[model samples]
Target: MTDSPLHVTVKLNAKLQPEHRHELFEDPLDALLESAELGQLTGGGTALTDEGEVDYGDIEIALTDPASLPGVIELLEQLGAPKGSLIQRAGEPDQPFGVTEGLALYLNGTDLPDEVYEQCDSNYVFEQIVERIEGVGEICSWWQGPTETALYLYGVSFETLRERIADLVATYPLCQGARVVKIA
Candidate 1:
């Protein structure tokens, strides 16, 4: 991995405006900064447009290492951001890193209105498999739909991630009726 800075473009959740970022993105952004090493949120923090709509959703951050891109995306997802974001060398769009390297699994089982909230602890289930994920993977960095808060994951390989999380998905009460679909 190069020590040269790279730009990571994060897609924010348009459902929320800049005013809500303090509670939604600030904490995680702060945590991410600890690892990303002083990257700033530029271009995406502007106020809402005159129509009261989100004018922009992508925030570009400078990273000290290209390898930390995935970690950055993972942290953003944990805070409920939209997915499908990308990273590239500071000035080279054609040279974006890992565009094809992203693989994901959506745990559409947790936080279901039908499931008991206490039992649907998405983070709890993650705790059970964090150690088992020997392969590269993470919760959604690029996801679809707004029907519900999607509990998705991104990984280097879908089969590996599915295998790693299968046990938890099969046995967890929260995972009942949950479909683990592979994201394109």
Candidate 2:
């Protein structure tokens, strides 16, 4: 049997353009600062201080299994920004998988259109999962395939991941079916 991987969630606060708020992106500590600067100049938001930096607010990032980091980064780049970036704050763990306190599950599926896939980012999926699990304490885990295929999700025992998968499969008209798989 494989052992569960250790995971750590990081939080970052940044300054961004309020106007371009919808187009913001998520990044690590260093990237967040750079993105915030660029976002402020492009989005037209004012820097809270005279340092020419816009306050993009805070974001909480959950790193599940750590092995998924590369995939997560790809997802973020595709999506405009990180998930739950609009509401998350520092010093928060985004609740727990169950107990109605944190993000529930991670989602994976296929059959996504080129345009849709291009528009999607890790942050987008991450935020979607967070929204679904909010107050319910679950995580939604699923994946989108390139063609007509089943959405398979594994390693999601948290309520947040579970609910997220359920919601995405239900809400997204593109998906046909969703299923859960055991983590190897």
The local distance difference test score of each candidate is 0.53, 0.36
Q: Tell me the deviation in Å of residue 170 in model 1.
A: 2.0
lDDT per residue for candidate 1 within 99-176, as digits (tens), equals 312233345533556635554676676676566664465543222334323344545565777788888778877666
Candidate 1, residue 57: the lDDT equals 50
* Model 1 alpha-carbon drift over 4 Å, by segment: 1-42, 45-57, 60-96, 99-120, 139-149
> Lowest-lDDT window of 10 residues in candidate 2?
96-105
**Model 2's TM-score against the true structure:** 0.26
TM-scores for all predictions:
0.42, 0.26
Candidate with the greatest TM-score versus the true structure:
1
Considering summed lDDT, which 10 consecutive residues are worst modelled in model 1? Answer: 94-103
lDDT per residue (tens digit) for residues 117-160 in model 2? 56655555556655655553322222223432222222223344
